[model samples]
Target: MTKDVEMAARNGSNGAVAGEAYYPPPPAQGGDVDVDDDGKQRRTGTVWTASAHIITAVIGSGVLSLAWATAQLGWVVGPVTLMLFAAITYYTSGLLADCYRTGDAHTGKRNYTYMDAVASYLSRPQVWACGVFQYVNLVGTAIGYTITASISAAAINKANCFHKNGRAADCGVYDSMYMAVFGVVQIFFSQVPNFHDLWWLSILAAVMSFTYASIAVGLSLAQTISGPTGKATLTGTEVGVDVDSAQKIWLAFQALGDIAFAYSYSMILIEIQDTVRSPPAENKTMKKATLVGVSTTTAFYMLCGCLGYAAFGNGAKGNILTGFGFYEPYWLIDFANVCIVVHLVGAYQVFCQPIFAAVEGFAAATWPNAGFITREHRVAAGKRLGFNLNLFRLTWRTAFVIVSTLLAILMPFFNDILGFLGAIGFWPLTVYFPVEMYIRQRGIPRYTTRWVALQTLSFLCFLVSLAAAVASIEGVTESLKNYVPFKTKS
Candidate 1:
């Protein structure tokens, strides 16, 4: 695996080299293997890594919350929305395949950082701006995960303690302490070497996947028993809210961020160019991977949407797992809490890795061989700016830890956090990045005159549908007021 990875990096036709190569580390001694505390040499991630990322990305809070996404358009549009999201994920993956091909053909360097790859080859400032947007989206994603995990932990402890002794409020303190402890642990581990140390992280991630699947299965079974004939029915009241048409349009437009997420994440293609065993010399492997990954993600989304709505019927909303009573017989709530925490921790690293690399690039450029600068630089500069350069690369690991912790503290509530997350972070990063990259790489005049005209009609349609999606999310708070099983009196 290591040899294959090295070969890909060496023979890259892409215009930019892997950033890791540009700042090469000292040569490793032959026959000397670095092993983690478990005495296992870090497996350079077999196919399992790819599978894990796909499942984790596909089955995040999105799947749990997708029922809410469908409610806006109506039950009829639910499957269709799943199809659309899947199609978009696949199409956007195609664009990334093209970028990877271009990099391989042009640079002789296969792997490039997201910004470096885009800026060096695509040659557009706005295209690089997409990287910035990706960072934002990732941070939002991390925050959502943290908040949800915290809520799950709280609810589980609350239910158990309340059941044992009729004082439920004590659960609140335990939940907060659990979240704080989790945050501190995240901060500590954020300093670990190589965010991509895949051994334990991969195992932990897979365990989480099983837990999520279990929760999904439990919900599916429960719904089946509750009322085999029960189905989600959308009434005019459910769909018709007070929001204006323009506002509705604006809201759906929010989903565009999903596109940006598709693009920036597509940069994982660069990693493929670096790793992956015996990837096709004709570069067909990348195309195949993209198709497989995106298709798989879409399928997962559809399943989640279908099962989630079916399970909750009219009650599904953001973090659908919460609607299931946070602590049921199958230990669903505790399982989800731990699993999501592990999943988000891994994702947070991936998201922050690029930022760290970029900052390191900046530091290197500014202070070439100045020993003092190198020594005191990370501390003086990083501490002052709230960046953690103590970690090997400050971008993904430490930065992600810091950002997730801070945001988790700030956005303590439920759907509010997810809604703000979808609107502010996910939409911009996912939607804008690819379009910006496409225009920048192709050139605005040509893109606008030729390509834009071709894609515009389709884009506008997506835009409108997405607008409806957003309106649906907006009306969710009111819908929640009516639908929640246990309502607090004013």
Candidate 2:
């Protein structure tokens, strides 16, 4: 096992990375049928299963913001931006998948996580940078999910309130309380051992994503066909009419960040790839999965975003599902919000598992003799379902949940926070590191045609990220003028 990637502290399971002592050993396997190159349980993730995981991670929370993002970009740029991100994500993700193995594409040692991949190809400084950016983004994502799930939960109540007390009802939604509830729910799911134990949950979350996204799309299409839609133009919102030139620029840049955020999951690409079994090679399987996943997500995004802009035009709500874009068929709207909450529950774990593993793994490795870090007590719950409880994991994970929940309560500016996270994470994790690692692993010479082209692409993306980050900060600053801490309205 590589020192850079001893992501778990516990002994045994040669290929294991992330979350110590939680994995069930391979079930009495024979031959190489159920074993990996590192001689642990052969990963059972196929292209479809991998695609499901990708969809689960990519589609939640971000999809809800697409309508407003599209409105900012207008008809011409909105759809174009979506395709551009899909293309960039697919291309760079392909580059990353090839870096799964250290030396050769097939038989080289595995790099199980994103930081592991960076540590394999880059120097110590770059490795440290990757760890900071990747882990921070993962924790940020956990916060974003808590905020989104609570918004959806509150939206359900708001919808019901409006249905009962007329459309003008002041449906008071307590976001802090809902955020706390979401935190409590995450505490339980956070205990779900490791990455490999997440297939079924990811599948369920993927289904929920499709369900809510499809509902939003169908509603938007209906509104589009019903006539009397809001103002729309090829160039998007007019500078003098909808916003000042400065506001226009900021909103457009923030819209770019939103789109970038929607295509996130590149930070965890290597981790996702690690779950795939070999034979066709992890890279090959991951590439196929990325194609299927990105294409599927792109198609749905087009429907949800473009149709939404058509329906509501420049007035598109920040979150189509929970932002009151659709009110009729209150039951369906409620169901859609419910699905969003459910989908985010699974997506939350998908991102948080890496963080949990990094911390718990370090604890176990640092103090090999510490029973508190290594011990597990199997406990039975209602219906007698069995699970493990580790003292350190329980304390640390609960604290993380509580902290994220509190942050969500303090700053519930959903779109601004998502844009900020997206802008900061998009360039380095998604584009730069992958491009650099690919060049180094393939030994592409500096200033060569391939190297120059890759560098040019990265530079352009860096510019985009810089602009979006600035815009997000400005948006958050603007939001602060009327903001009251721990009080978020729907």
Candidate 3:
């Protein structure tokens, strides 16, 4: 049977003997392909859990900034650019799914992580490249979330402490203090044993995301309908379009980069897909999960971006929630900010898990017993935990949270940090790797039009990323011209 399976795999057909047909294959006899100590696999999720994970990872603080992005590009370019990103992301995500599987049923192999896939299809050097960008992007994303959560907490706190005359009664409670508080909370939640353990947290985070997004859209609609007449503008005409063509073009590219960043989840697709049950249909399941997740996210992005632009016109803040201030409808604003805080807590974990997994995997490979919890310790603890909370894991994860928190407190320009992350992360993780992997996996000819087009697209994405990096640096430099550390935003 094994020889036949190998032969069929070599022939590039489903693993069936000459006389036999490939019908529905039998269920995997093993409990799970990725089993734990008790001989049970942890792959116990369905499409819903997978969708929840994708949604939680994808629709983060990025959505909060889309209105400002829209304002930069105006309604026509903004919505169109967002939809374009959605399509491109969806297409490349399918390419990634194809790379996850190799060989035929009985003799097939699956990539357990993104780096695994990269190393398999590309080279070890490329794997290292992917890992570097992947970890940096994840860490940057977590820092962004820390800043967002701090902002939400500060808003909530200030709302509770405000007087009737629009003054913050407790002005001393700054964003940095709340950022520290958020970091402490994350240090606890970041200890979840594995990606599978975060399934429920992702679900709750998705719900929280939906709650705040709905509130944002509702608030925007209400303001547009009931507030001052002629305040909202659709075209750039009323908002006073950028007079200089060069400035207008730069803003357009910046918005493009922001949209690309908002749509990025390719970095963690394999990690999330690993939690799905093993079968012939795992790839299909993952594709469906991506479609469902992206569809839901794009809908919210469009509504929030369009409505937010309409409500604020050219005056939209980097964070749409900030537009509400600490005044009337303050309770709703507080509730929405609380939802954002809760959602980002889960988002921080979602992005950070891949980093933890990669570090632990590397440690295990480097030192055979590095990530292990000894039998003696397990017995003393009186529990059969699936993962080791060894000294390295405890120390590094804690330090990562601490460092990211400090960075957030030190540099609180949300949009600038996001632009920087998007610039550094978008090309390698989102565009270049996936397209190159797909072309290599399929043996596409180098000089063919398809190959050339994709390579061109990757180069274009790289240029956009570079421009965004420069713009972000300029923005940060302007903000920090005085170079004050740990300065809170007023």
Candidate 4:
């Protein structure tokens, strides 16, 4: 049985590569071996399930901010930039997928996570670098989601307060208090035993994503047609060309960063791909799933961004939902806020799983007998009842949630943080590693036209990411000047 497990891991179900030259780390610990009680393999998800997972991960609070992003760039640049990023991401996603298998389909080995792929195709130094950025991106994303969810909760509470009173009410439920409540909810769902167990949640979250996005677009279009309640003005014209060129450039670059962040799902591509059923046609399955997910998300982005800018114009808040104000259709506004909170819960988990996997894998690798790999708990009717929870797992996972919750409470600059994370992460996770690994995997010669073009793209992404990072820092600093921590404004 043990030998069979080893053989199965070595000869991945996916037939992309053909040699046993590249072997993954031990599976008994945490290297992507799904075995039953009797030690046989277990097949899990389909292409649609995978697509749902990708969609759930990709589309989150990012979509909510697109209207503002559009407002920053105006209609012409907004939609075009988004479409361009979509194309770039799709192309890079294909590159990442191709790196999943190491041998031929019949006997090829598979990379279970992003770091795994990096270690296999790239150098150890690259692996360490990738691991740091990937985990940072995931943890940072989880923190962002926590903040967004709390904001949604706060918005809902604020709306109810306004309904009870004649004006906006100080509900005493600031972002921190809401985050505390949200932390408890995340703690429960975060304990779901495995990635496979969360697919249903992902599907529901995908549905929720489409639901709120459609509502947002519908509301914006209606508002636009009826004439905007707030003063409406075009982007470039509102600021005027007479304004400081430096300030105009700063805003433009910041918008570029936001758009980049909106498409920042490359960090978790391998982790999502890892969930597919073995004999996994990773290349084909993931490609198809990426197309479906990206296409769906792109449609939503374009509609919400263009229509939202049209409705609110330069008056759009960082979150378009907030721009709806406590108006006549207050019920729909509340429902939309509720949906955002719900979707964020799922988004938090989709990213965190990779972090959990990476940490557990490291623990297992370091201490072979620590029981950190896979421990058996009680079993139910032919099924595993609960997770293989241990002191390390419980302690670290709980601490992670607590820390992220705290960060969300402390620094609630949603758009600024999103831009910062995207800027810092874009170069390494999105462009550099993927392109470099692809060159090595495909054995593309240096200085060739294809190589030069890809390299130039990577360099461009790096420069833009750096500029975005600086701009994000400035934005955060400026926001902090007005921020009164833990205080709820009436």
Candidate 5:
């Protein structure tokens, strides 16, 4: 499969729920030709390429909040939590990879997407639930991206203001305005010709993610080595000194959600698996790739989160780059923030375009004869530089952008939002679905020790998600008391 397949499956996930079983179209008979059994070009992906894809998909702007999360959980719980989440993701990923082939791990019909696997193994209700999770997660991600990008943009402006004026000068930049500007930009990009086909956008976003993550790690390392670090404890922030007991509990819960968010890539694991060749079987290769990617990612996260905590223990900003953690090296900070804005611009489309396509596809299917919905008018600025514009496409995409931006404005609590998104996704997408699928596929009987273990694990994660959601909501409520819409500051 091409990278377009990966990007489509990355966010809005293939398409809507058709409420039917997924059966792969029969391959052409006597397929000993150049094409694979499925009649597509033979995949050339190796364990290394698969590993690279997994790493890129997992690490993103989400890593920026690790230090703050670490501070909430303190030294002991923080790293342990990161490692634990990594292990869980890795194990569940192997289970998911096994589900890629319906019957056998090596040679059953390919279930190309997560929904494909769920539809093949699970029930109709599961298919619908999976669709809801994928779509809701994609839309929430769009809104989260908007909020994150605007904060980075406002950080640049605020950094400039601080540099120009005295240290005490008010350098508050309105986050909601930046968010609105970003929404307007996305509205324009939404109409690009075959926007999903611009696979380079995904590459660019990955590069930007690495650049900022590297900058964050470097800055935090420098801060730690330079000495005079803040107070840090094995138990983390003090209950009475840094926060009240209730606030401590809330922060810990939110911290769990934040760490969960940092590892949010299981939704696309099957797509990544689909890219691999099958001499060694895609499942085996994907299992290796998951080990490499998750292990490497965990090490990187430890460096970023641990060093940032060492630099500003109990005071790490929710976002390392935009959170005013470092004032000097203003140029580097500005560049990092610029990279963030650029990355998110593409990453937004990486996710939201699938959503746009899914909705537009459903509309066309529903109203086949409606010209406004089904017809694409080829509008040209020049002979060769134009795209087919449809009224439904333009209006629906714009409305989506507007609504997401408005939601971001209403609740501009960055950490709280990230935590909430993570909590909502962690249980169902990462744990429940994969575990359930593994059991059904393997025909594990009920009340078996293995079955009980899986269910127990799922229940534990559900409790964590529940607690995280409550904490994030509480955090948002607390934030609302201080800031109104259009008034969030850098």
Candidate 6:
């Protein structure tokens, strides 16, 4: 029998491939080619490429809004909160790597769908609900990213004399236009026929991201508040040392958001490793991915967080734009804005891909004959576009851009969208994904001292996230209350 014919039979009439199925022979492996192209089967991602994905994914608009979020949590606790969260994120990612390895070894399924495994093993609707929430959270994350990118780019352009009036309202206008433009650009960049070569783009993106962040951090440290005549003076005491009790609680809760961000992407790192050609049996790829990812993310977080608190002192905000905008000579604002724009593009790619894929997946099932609306159709069109489709490949790029533009215009005013989204959406994806996966793989992850300690910490992290989500939503609502048009004054 032919290879396709055999797979079709083995896969059954419903077209569902069994989770426990093993690789058949060479011809069969080569025959079922939907997952990877010929070159893709041979291409493996490097440590640098994996690192880029992890770092970019974590450093979204949240990096920009972190200052504000931390401030809302309490200014005195801001930096401490960032550091505390960074530590949790680092450890949680490590624990996730261990869980992934254990599960893969036991299941003999190196390429397991995280949700499928979790859902099957946990056998709980809440687990599945969490997974669904994760997916939605990621979508919100993409929205947050694109909106932030628009605002950053607008701020950069205005500072560079691109905007004539330099109007505050223009920030929102420029942001919306950028959303449309970036969406178009992403369609092409994403459609690159040669993904192996695309690693170079990720490299350039990473260099831009890290280098700009480093410089921004440095400039922030060297900054001195000036008088009206522009004369510099020593001012702005160090922030976040010996914070008050309320500030301490705020910092702790903010830290939970950071942990959620890290947890959300652990499975992505594992997926990328598995996709590599001739992957390590000992799975050294997981170690490499995690080590580089955690280290890079931690360093950037520290640099941005510390310099920001130190420079602006009480005035500093959490977002990268805040760090970028607080520098002297004015021209630095343009430079910082530009860096944020470039870095945000790379970050947006990682955040948007899964949401786009999920939307495409549902579209395909719901409307099998919708032409280019399905993921399969988009892939085929992408093959034709060869990475620069302009407008043809993946039209949803335009739709996403439009949605993001509208969201950027509206939600940014809310000022706490990042924290709110991170709280409501990011928590389940990051905190619960690994724990649920581990529970599925090995019941309750053993009650050893270390495991028990981690679980307690994880549970605490969950509670913090729950509180943050609730508080942020309430805060947003309260802020909106002031803007609401009432018929009568109180």
Q: Judged by TM-score, which candidate is best? A: 2
Better candidate by TM-score, 3 or 5 = 3
**Global CA lDDT of candidate 2, please?**
0.85
Compare the candidates by lDDT and give the number of the best one. Answer: 2
Candidate 6 at 40: error in angstroms?
A: 7.8
> Each model's TM-score, in the order given?
0.71, 0.93, 0.86, 0.88, 0.85, 0.73
**Over the stretch 1-490, how does candidate 2's per-residue lDDT look in tens digits?**
2221232344322222322223433322254335676755568899988999999999989998999999998999999999989999999999999988988788998876787788778887898888888889998999998899998898889888888898887888889989999999999888777788889999999999999999999988887898668788887888999888999999999999988999999988887887888788889999999999999999999999998888888988889875444367889999999999999999999998878776766677677556687666667676546676778888999899999899889989899999989999999999999999989888899899999999999999999999999999999999999999877776
Q: What is the C-alpha RMSD of each candidate to the true structure, in Å?
A: 8.3, 3.6, 7.8, 5.2, 5.5, 7.0
Residue-wise C-alpha lDDT for candidate 1, range 1-490, written one tens digit per residue: 2342233223222232223312212123456555422222332443555555545554555555565454434466666755765665556545544454343443344334555446545545654465555556556666666666666566566667655666544444434455566676666655533435433664466467557756665676576577552346652014344235664444334323322232235434443333333333313554565566566656555565566667666555556566565345536566666677676566554544444444444543444453322322223344334222322343435555665666565545445445444444333333344454555556667555656763673465445435534643664555555543322111
Flag the better candidate by TM-score, 2 or 3: 2
Task: Enumerate clash totals for all models, in the order shown.
Answer: 25, 0, 0, 6, 0, 11
Q: Which stretches of candidate 5 lie over 4 Å from their true place?
A: 1-56, 104-112, 191-198, 271-289, 322-326, 368-392
Give the Å error, residue 138, model 1. Answer: 2.6
- Candidate 3, residues 68-122, lDDT tens digits: the string is 7888777787898789778878888888877765544223566667777787678
Q: Give the higher-TM-score candidate: 3 or 6.
A: 3
Better of 4 and 6 by lDDT: 4
The C-alpha lDDT values of all candidates are 0.49, 0.85, 0.75, 0.76, 0.78, 0.51
* Candidate number that wins on TM-score, 1 or 3: 3
The true-versus-predicted C-alpha distance at residue 348 of model 5, in Å, is: 2.2
Candidate 5 backbone collisions, by pair:
none
* Per-residue accuracy of model 4 over 386-472 as CA lDDT, tens digit each: 333445556777888998898888888888888888888888998898899899988999999999999999998888899888888
Which prediction has more favorable lDDT, 1 or 6? 6
